[model samples]
Each structure stands twice: as structure tokens, then as C-alpha cells.
Target: MTANRFTFRRLDLQDMAQASRIHRAAFDNSLPWLKGLHTPQEDQWFYENCVFEQCEVWAAFSPDMAGIIAFKTGWIEQLYILPDFQGHGIGSALLRQAQTTFPHLQLWTFQRNIQAQQFYEKHGFIAIGKTDGSGNEEKEPDMLYEWRRAGS
Candidate 1:
């Protein structure tokens, strides 16, 4: 699908590197305190082995990867937009792939990311639960957000 200058497509193995770059850049940008939490190799490995192998990965490319989302039947593992792509609809377009596919969806966002919290809230996702700085590699407190389609 195409929207504006962006086109959406299933992420292929060749996209592992770009997807990892977007995830790491956005993750560190949104959580500066957790910057460099993983090396480039680790990020690439995770994207290759975990995300690509597990989820239905997709991306929005304005001739280049502007955003990416990794999602399964009921969970969104990752959603990131390149810094330059923020404020555009790339994130929302990638998110809609999941929201439109499943009747419901859930994902985690760090508690400190107010912008991310607001973005999800604006898109009809509600904070369904929370956790302390545990159970995660970053040990950052996070909230679980859920979205259910209207009448679903």
C-alpha cells in the first residue's frame, strides 16, 4: 500500500539491517538514558532472529525505510519511526497494519516516554497495566497498553 510518499511492504531478510537501525535509533532517542543498551550486532541479531522470525514485520518506506513495526496476532513487539520521519504519518500507517489486522493488540512502552504514551493514547490504546524496573533487559519501568477495535 502507498500513502503520500510512503509505501508499505513486508520486511524481507534484506531489511533486517534497516529495521534494526530504525529500532535502535528510535529506542535510544525515546530513551536517552538507555542509549547504547545494545550493540549494533545485538540489535541486528534480535531483529534477524527474534523479530523477523516471530512477527509479521512491515515497513513504511519513502523510498527508504522511514518506520517499521513488528507484530503478531495479539502483540506488537516493536514500532519505531526514524527521527526524521517523526510527525509524519509513517508510524501511524505502520501501526494501522496491526490495528486493522487483529481485533485487539497490546504493546509495552517505557513509563518515561510521555510522547509515546500520548501517541498510543491518541490512537485508542489504553494503559492496561504497569510494571516496575524489572522483567526487562533495560530494567526500565514500563506500561502495557491495549487496543481493541470498536465493537470487536
Candidate 2:
């Protein structure tokens, strides 16, 4: 899709379910090893209770919900684009939206997700730290990334 084609806006309660679906699809596609780790119900609950309650969620819609970014303060909790929409600038647009909101941001992605690593790095997020699988529920190694506005 063209970069200007997508509509970006804040998410509402009615959107939590679709956001959960997008997260599951993108997460499983990127990290197949973790597929089925969470039930659809659990994902929905997380979105409604944790994500919606804690962060501000914004989504991209190229006629449909294409991607979402959940962020708060100096951290980005989630950013997922539908697999069908991957690599089409939707993700970058959402990420840039988040960057524009916060002067600094931090997020974590599984170590094995090379595409995500490269994507974040390209957007100026640097690897600040890493950890073995033990620290997270998935028990998978992860890399911590941070991005800050120039002179901030």
C-alpha cells in the first residue's frame, strides 16, 4: 500500500479484539516457536485489561486495521502489522507515530527475530541490552532497544 494510503488513529474498546488477532498473527509469523503459547481469549484479555488500561494504542488502517502501536511514557509495549501487510511501510509509519509522541522509547523483541532487529535499528533504535530466555514468560532470549530524539 502507498505510504499515504493508510489512516492512523487511536484505538478504542471496540478495536481490542481485532488488535489481539493482529498481534497473534504477526507474533506467530515472526516467532513460530511461540505459536499457541497464548490462547485467543488470553490475548484478548491482555489487550483489554493490560494494554488498553496501561498504554495508548494507535492503529493503521488501509481500509482495514493493518497495524497497531501500543505505547506509554518512554516505552512501546507492542507494535504489530498483519502478515499480509508486512514490509509495506505500515510498520514504519506506526513506529514513526510512536516516536513522534515520545522523546525516548524502549522496547524488546525476541533475539531470533532478525527482521525486527534490523527494522528497529534502521529506525534509530539501538541495542542497549540483552537477556537469556529466563527473564520472560516465553523463555526466549531477547534484545532491548532504545530510541531517543536528537539532543534529548
Candidate 3:
């Protein structure tokens, strides 16, 4: 799909189900530990009450919800796109939105998700640290990436 066809907008509570589906589908395909670990209902609840309430969320819709990104202060908490929507510029668009919102931003990605690591790096995020996963629910190896404005 053409990038121009996608509309970006603030995500509301009503978009939780679609957002969670994209989150689950993307993670299931990219992260081995998350596969089949949570049901749609569980994801919906967590994203709606726990995540959405705490962050500023933006979504890309090709007339239909395609992907979402959530950020709080200077941290990008979550970014996900549907499998079918991958490589279509939705992820980059979401990342650009985050950059526009914050002069500097930070995020964590599973160490095993090489594609994601590359994506963030390509977008100017640098790997500033690595962790053994002690602080995350998955308890899997992860890395922290950060991006700063050109002069900041």
C-alpha cells in the first residue's frame, strides 16, 4: 500500500482490540517467548488499562487500523504493526511520529529480534545498553536503544 494512503491519528480506548491484535501478531511472529503465551482478551486488558492509559498513542490506519505506537515522556513503550502490514512503511511512519514528539526517545527490544534491532538502528536509534532481562516480564535478553535530535 502507498504510504500516502495511510492515515495517522490519536488512538482511543475503542481501538484497543485492533491495537492488541497487531501487538500479538507482531510479537508472536517475532518473539519466540511470546508465542501463544497470552490470549487476545489478556492483551486487550493490559494494553487498554495498563499501557494506553499511561502513554500517548498514535496509530496508522489504511482506512483500517494497521499499526500503533505508544510513548510516555521520553520513552517509546511499544510499537507494533500487523504481519501483513510489515515492510509497507507503517513502522517507519510510527517511529517518525515518535521522533516528532520527543527530542530524545528510548525503547527496549528483545535481543533476539534482529529485524527490529536493525529497524531501530536505521532510524537513528543507538544501542546504549544491554540487559539480561531481569527487569522485564519475559525475562529474556534485551537491549535498550536511544535516539536524539540532531543537535540534542
Candidate 4:
């Protein structure tokens, strides 16, 4: 499908269910350590209250919601797309939108998620730090990536 098929927009409270579904599905599928970590209901509740509350969220919709990217201050808190929509430009679209909005942005990705690392790197993000599974709930090794505007 062409990029024209997708619409990007800021999301609100009404979009909670759809956005949470993408978030839960993407993480649950990609992260081995996250399997069974939380019930679907628990995840939804957390997404709405914790994740949604903390960030400004934008979604890419292929008539229906296909993906979302959420960020706050200088941090990209979340980005997720449905598995069926993975290979398309939905993720790139969302990240481009986020990058345009935040001249400098940073995010954390699990060390095991190589696809994510590669994607971010392709978009000009560079690893700035690494952790030994101490600060996050998942208790897994993670890396921090940062993107800054040229000459900034």
C-alpha cells in the first residue's frame, strides 16, 4: 500500500483501547522477558493511566489504527505497530513525525531487540548508554539511543 493510505494524528483518551492493543501486542511478541508479565487487562489499564498520561501520543492509521509513537520532553517513551503492519512504512512515518516534533529525542530499547536497534540507527539515532537491567521493570539489559538535530 502507498503512504497515502495512512493518516497521522494526535491521539486522545478515546483512542486508548486501540493504542494499548498495539502496544501490548508489539512488546509481548518481541520481548521474551515480557511474556505473561502482565494480564491484558493490566496492560491496558497501565497504558491508559501510566503511559498515556505521561506522554504526547500520535498514531498512524490505515483507516484503522496501525501504529503509534508517544514521547514527552526529550524522551520517546513508546512506539509500536501491529505485527501485520510491521514491514510497511507505518513505523517510519510515526518516527519521522516524532523526530520533526522533537529536535532532540532519546529512547531506551531492550538489548535483545535488534530490529528496534537497527531501525533507530537507520533514522540517525546513536547509542549513548547501556544498562544492566537495574532501572526498568523488565529487569533486562537495555540501551539508550539519542537523536539530535544537525548543528544542535
Candidate 5:
């Protein structure tokens, strides 16, 4: 799909539910620690107390679809696109726009998620380090990625 086919808008309080759902869905399998857990209350809390203020959430919506493609960009936060919307350049568009405000950007992805790593690399983000966010080395390893503006 072309960029013009969707409209990008700033996330508002009214979009909290949808945004939370999108976030949970996008990170579902990538973060095994959260597997089988439904934390809508926690999600709402984070969206209200942390996410809404610290990050800028943008959603790309198509009139033909019932849901929106959402992404949140902040200090060390991420750009998450729904599974159904992946590989369509929507994530790239969101990342590009986020970079306009915060030129130096970074994000963490699960080490096992090769597709996500490749996607970040394809968009010029370089792996800088790794961490075991799950606290158990055998479970989940998170890879840190950073992107510096051209010539920087």
C-alpha cells in the first residue's frame, strides 16, 4: 500500500484502548515473559501514566479497515506495527517521522526475533548492545539498536 492510502494521526486519550490492544498484540510472541498474560489494567495504566506523556503515538488508518496501525516513539521506546500491517512500509514511515523530531533514536528487540532485527538493520539502525530483560539468560535476550542521523 502507498503512504497516501493511510492517514497518520496523533494518539489521543480516546485511542487508549485501541493503542493498548495494538501494543499487546505486536509484542505478544516477541516477549515470552508476557505470554498468556492479559494485563489490560496494567496496559491502561502505562498508557496513561507513562506512554501518553513520554512518547508520541501515531496511528495509520485505512478507511477499509476496522483497526489502526499504531506505533509509539520515545526515549528508548519503539515503533510497533500490527502483524497484519507488517512489511508494508508502514513501520518505516512511522520511524522516519519519529526521527524528524528525535534524530538519534534507539530501540530494543528480542534477540530471537530475527525478522525485527533485520527490519531495524534495513532501516539503518545498528545493533549496539544486548541485555537479558527477562533476567533469565536462557529465556529472552534483548538486542539494543541505535540509529544516528546521516553524517552524525
Candidate 6:
């Protein structure tokens, strides 16, 4: 779909439920290191507090459906699209917008998640370091990636 066909909006408290559902579904099993990151209660808490206070979440919506494209600050907190909405350029648009605020961005992905590593590399982010889980020992070895805006 073309950029013109999608509308982007800042996520509000009311949008949290949908966003949490999408987030949990998209990242849960896919990013094993973050496996239990969003239990129902945590999801609700994040939507009610953390999301609006510490991060910026943008939703991309078409006439029929909506999904979260990106969330970030100095770091990319999350980037997820509904299964049906994947590969429609919403992810790229969201990243582009986020780069405006965080000219240099960084994020972590499980070492075993090759797809996410590839996606980050394709988007100009370079593997910078590694850490042992983000507290999820079940999924150890997290790879850290960083992207510096062209000149910086």
C-alpha cells in the first residue's frame, strides 16, 4: 500500500488495549528473550503508564484495520505490525519518523532471532554488542544493534 493510503496517529490511552494485544502477539514468541514481557497485567500497566510517559507509539491505520508501527525514544522500544499488516511499508515509515527524534537509535534482539537481526542490518543498524538476556535467562545472549543517522 502507498503511504498516502495509510494514516498515522499518536497512540492514546484508549488505544492501549489494542496496542497491547498487537504487541503481545507480535513479539512474544518471536522474540523469546522478551517472552513474558507483556503478561496481561504488565500490558495494561504499560498502556496505562509506561507507554505514554516513557515512549512514543504511533499507529498506522487503513480503512479496515490498524496496527502499531513503531515505539521509541533514545532507543527503539518496540516495532510491531499485525500479522496481516506486515510488509506494507508501515514499519519503514514508523522508523523514519522515529529517527527524527532519536537520530541515533539502538535496540536488542535475541541472538537466535535471525530475521530481526537481518531486518535491523538491512535498515542500517549495526551489531554493536551483546548481553546475556534482558533478564530472561531462558533466552540468553541478546545482540545489541545501533544505527547512527548518516552524518552523526
Which digits, one per residue and each the tens of the lDDT, describe model 3 over residues 6-103?
99999889888888888888889888667988889999998899888999888999888888999988999999988888999999998888898889
Off by over 4 Å in 4: none
Candidate 1 residue pairs in clash (backbone atoms < 3 Å): none
Best by lDDT: 2
Question: What number of backbone clashes does candidate 4 have, counting pairs of residues 3 or more apart or in separate chains?
Answer: 0
Off by over 4 Å in 2: none
Which residue ranges in model 3 land beyond 4 Å of their true spot?
none
lDDT of each: 0.91, 0.93, 0.90, 0.88, 0.70, 0.75
In the range 42-115, model 5's lDDT, one tens digit per residue, is: 87777766777777777777752222333344344646667777767777777777777666877877888898
Which residue pairs of candidate 4 clash? none
The stretch of ten residues in a row with the least summed lDDT in candidate 4 is: 31-40
Model 5 reaches what TM-score against the true structure?
Answer: 0.82
As for candidate 2, its clashing pairs are none
Tell me each candidate's TM-score. 0.96, 0.98, 0.95, 0.94, 0.82, 0.83
State, as a TM-score between 0 and 1, how close model 2 is to the true structure.
0.98
After superposing candidate 6 on the true structure, give the runs of residues whose Cα lies further than 4 Å from its correct spot: 29-38, 69-72, 134-139
Q: What would the per-residue lDDT of candidate 4 be over residues 1-152, giving only the tens digit for each residue?
A: 75568999999987887888888888888885678888878877877898789988999888999889999879999999888888788888888887888899999999999999999999999999999989999899999999998888
Candidate 2 Cα lDDT to native: 0.93
- lDDT for 152 in candidate 3 is 81
Sliding window of 10 residues with minimal summed lDDT for model 3: 29-38
Candidate 5 overall lDDT versus native: 0.70
Measured on C-alpha atoms, candidate 3 has an lDDT of 0.90
Better of 1 and 6 by lDDT: 1
